[model samples]
Target: MKVVIQRVKEGKVKVNGETVGKIEKGIVVLVGFEKGDIPSFLEKMADKIVNLRIFEDSEGKMNLSLKDIKGELLLVPNFTLAADCKKGRRPSFQSSENPEIAKNMFDKFVEICRKQIPVETGIFGAEMEVYILNDGPVTFILDSRELFQGGLS
Candidate 1:
């Protein structure tokens, strides 16, 4: 599992010109499932995200968490995060999980996140136009493989 987390003032997802999901004062999470991803990563990642101290506090330090601020969350499925572009001119999605399985995983992830904060989600496998007003342009990437293997601290 891989996730790109962006702190945003607001974010929305539109499908066929119709808004599907929207959020204000929160983070936009672009999540991807790789071939070896398991269900356990969902809960861990959700906890990490909601508790992550990315928002600013009264002292102008990044000391507040989404939970502390009562912020919302926008979750978007993005299999391309698994793209392997190290060799060829074209990016390869060979590591991406099977769509059917990944969709289930995505739904489960959303459920887990929703339990912690107000959550919105882009339709999986749908063509979406995502609009984001990034807050401080702050962003971070989390990969389950690295996270579980002590590669990220």
Candidate 2:
């Protein structure tokens, strides 16, 4: 699993010109599932993201977490995040999980996150137009492989 997290003032996703999900004063997460991703990683990543201290505090330091601010979350499924582009001109998606399995994983991740904070999500497997008003343009990339103690299980 990999996620690109962006702190944003507001975010929304549209599919075929119809807004599907929207949020305000939160972060936008673009998540991808890889071939060997497991269920355990989803809970760990969800905890890390909501409690991450990316928001600013009274001292102008990045000391406040999304949970502290009572912010929302926009989760977007993006299999392209798993693309292997090291070799050829075209990116290879051989490492991405099968769509059927990935969709289940994605749903599980979202369910886990929703228990912690207000959550919204883009339709899985849909072509979405995401609009984000990024706060401070702050962003981070998290990969489950690097985060886990023994790597992916």
Give the number of the best model, judged by lDDT.
Answer: 2
In the order shown, the candidates' Cα RMSDs to the true structure are: 1.4, 1.8
lDDT string for model 2 (68-116, tens) is: 9999999999999999999979999999999999999999999999999
Each model's TM-score?
0.97, 0.97
- Alpha-carbon RMSD, candidate 2: 1.8
Q: How many backbone clashes does candidate 2 have?
A: 0
> How well is each residue in 15-49 modelled by candidate 1, as lDDT tens digits?
99999999999999999999989887888899999
For model 1, what is the alpha-carbon lDDT of residue 153?
Answer: 41
lDDT of all predictions:
0.95, 0.96
* Cα-based lDDT at residue 128, candidate 1: 95
Candidate 2's C-alpha runs over 4 A off are 151-153
